[model samples]
Target: MSRIPDLPGVISSDEIVASAEHLAGLQTDSGMIPWWPGGHCDAWNHVESAMALDVAGLHREAERAYEWLADIQRPDGSWHNYYLPDGDRDMAVEDDKVDTNVVAYIATGVWHHWKCTSDRSFVDNLWPTVERALDHVLSLRKDDGLVLWAVEADGTRRWDYALLTGSSSIQHALRCGAAVGLATGSPRPDWVDAADRMCSLIANEPLAFQPKTRWAMDWYYPVLTGAIEGEAAKIRLADGWPTFSMEGLGIRCVSDEPWITASETAEASLAYASIGEFATATDLLRWTRSHRCPDGSYLTGLVYPDKVVFPEGETSSYTAAAVVLAADAIAGASPGSDLFVRSSLRPS
Candidate 1:
């Protein structure tokens, strides 16, 4: 028998529809899912929100997003980190190509959605985009299995730093890709090995440099991305409950201070469930609900008064993805059931 979903209360169909409707408004005709109604576009947020739409049974919106990504993909298969409402590039790295290593790895989610609905056309249309993106990213892999943060077409430093987050996400994308290859009878060993190396590296050694930030994503993403597994993964979860986690609003981006944000919080909460911590996952999901906005958008951060930063009022596609992803975890959709993370672990 299928397990019953334990969603927050009896959220009316109307409420879910309203939330979905608000999400629909965020979608531009160009197919990009902006953060707020008129906020900047980001690759990370795009894939994250697409995954959310997939889980919600909104395949068309999600497909549109992938198409948007494909249309804007650089010749080398990379994308800038950000863009404007007019589709004009903004805040791009020096190379104008993004290191979106974490962002590009969302193929796992895409393939997972494909498996659920048996949508061959979605797979056919997106296969090329996924392939090219992976090909570009795989070129960045280092001998140690860690990818350079970002390299320009001319080969210059973008992020110029190795991030544990990037490695973990790549690992996830590779795994998801491998799953797709197997299902589609197109298994690629190179991709799987690359993902394996990334996971092995992170598990054996700490690669993420921002240790000072009290962000919980650093603590849990390793496992969530499949870098650590079995007893080790479980142990990491037990050890990290206090190390990087904040009590209420969710995990901070790092351990440096008290900086809490919705996306990271949701990501961390989902991470908890990734390792089978249902109790904590349930709590974090509840906390996230309290922050839900009237129009179904979510708050970005809580680093107020002390952090002299304008609280961006717009809710983001990534933020929405984080929220829905966390809810899916609470509803028993975990890494075991996660296809997005799996395909993300695959090669192009």
Candidate 2:
């Protein structure tokens, strides 16, 4: 990966590197990056952290992170929602819900690493992991094209509803998976079909996804995942601006809530950049600086007005990862930054 250049008024490249190093320091010897020391790790957030590592030129650590994921993957291609850093089960959350988005994200992470480093060997080795992960995720697809959010511990799909953010994110993952298939001479036309269908569902049928409109992610995730674009994306951002955004503190976690989170703010910036709104993206990124700690790590979010850290003052590796990704997008630092803006798979 090329060196990330400094963005003078927003974040310096040195600070970006320092943030990445902070995340790297959090990774356990087993390669898992928990939310914090003694905290649990989830597959989705773990991949996000690994992608940040790749963007920061920590290729070896990124590879090890993926290898750790590969080592622990369930035979059915699913992972429990959370785990201890030492590869042990996180028993605190008794619910063993296997999240579709968490499983599907490996494809995005694998494809991202390949894009940043051009490591064909890494992609080839990880191809099976991606293939199986997608297989599990696609199996959760309902007839209407929305992927069910999770599989219960009973091995049944959570058919009650799908999430707009999760389904939108899965669409991007499917496209990345298809791209991996094509690059490796392993074409997955089924994944392409699923992606096209999912995009249509996200673009045309908001009602199909469960009503989580109260959350900020529901507003911008479709655009961030490339399901919504062009003028539609601009309109989406405009529609939710008054409800979700605060002037300088960052994006609120919920419209009615006072909490502003680093991960959501960073992701919102990506949504803006995906639509060619670089200035707005930069402005949003500047808000993220307030969430940064003296050591270059980011707080998960803050409760506004009171101006206190949320979740009892946790600073998460995933939150740090989100900031790194937003910086990369704004600076055009890595090929992976284009993952959110690129078109979906074309049928062969």
Candidate 3:
């Protein structure tokens, strides 16, 4: 079988060296991939870094990240957005997020690591953790098919409503859960319903989450899942492209005001590929990979600190997650695999 390669822009000798350097240089001593020296961690960032470690074949380092999540997961199957270097809580949100989606993200992480390394122990060990977390996340779903925004880390409720990004994110995670459920020999009807309900909200209703903003993440993610597919997705995607996209740089998390966002662009590129816009997707990925360091890590955002300023530094997790998902779509392993050039997931 002809397998896909790891890391985008990694072809020539120099590119290979750069990827190796980027991968090795990006690691922290604690084995938990930090976004930046003094930065906080979120579910998205953690999962992104773990996938990046998988791309680099740093399985142990990657496994540690999954463990980091397992250790810190709240009793109610969610994670706080921030954690201090000592593995203690740092900045706590006023209300805890019912991070069922993020909690379910580990299924993708474990599955990706298993495919890359074929490590059965890693997959088998986390079965219960995955099971219980999904159980709790599923507990909060509403009759209209919306999941709650979040709960307190201590299991208190956070909000009575749902956020668009949060709902979109969890929808993807629920699909990941289905995949995990299939893998573990214990599939749940609730998970399938969660995926189907989230899809219905995305496809059938406009007011699924918060009103649709021009954030590129919001634009393309529905396509990444089976939530929005085919030509309708293309229109929904292109409709918002001009508002936030720069021809070469990336996207802004929101439209109208604020600065551009690299993480959003990278992920949006993956979403674009889901709809088969290979040219646009690769261009964004190339611009992103071009900005990468010799060590294979990438800066988190662009136009930060101030909109006029250049991006600061490696949100290895962000870049890593983008790379993996984009690559997955490209390589045809992902549900929306029709997006990539080959089956490499590296659309560019």
Per-prediction tally of clashes: 31, 0, 18
Runs off by more than 4 Å, candidate 3: 1-30, 87-98, 304-307, 310-316, 324-348
Q: List residue ranges in candidate 2 displaced over 4 A.
A: 87-95, 342-348
The C-alpha lDDT values of all candidates are 0.65, 0.86, 0.61
Each candidate structure's TM-score, on Cα atoms with residue i matched to residue i, is 0.85, 0.95, 0.81
Q: Which of the two candidates, 2 or 3, achieves a greater lDDT against the reference? A: 2
Residue lDDT tens for model 3, 24-112: 45445544445565445665567666765555455677787777667666666666655545534333343244455566666656656
Write model 1 residue lDDT over 1-348, tens digit each, in one string: 122233655223334445555676788888877777777777766777776666666778878877788777777777876676674423333334567474456566667567556777677667777767777788776666678777655656555556777778877787677666666666778888888777767888673343423456667778776678768978888887776556765666666656667677777766766666667766776655644678766767666325322264545567656777666555643332454233232223
Question: For residues 1-348, what per-residue lDDT tens digits would candidate 2 score against the true structure?
Answer: 477736798999889889889988988887888889888888999999999999889889999889988887888888888886444433244247898998999999999998999889989999999999999888887878778888885668555678999988898899899999999999998998998898888888878888999999999999988888778878989999999999988999999988999899999998988887778888999999888998779898899798888887789998889988988887777777777754232112
Weakest 10 consecutive residues, lDDT, candidate 3? 333-342
Evaluation by lDDT, superior candidate among 1 and 2: 2
True lDDT of residue 30, candidate 1: 82
How many Å off is the CA of 16 in candidate 3?
7.4
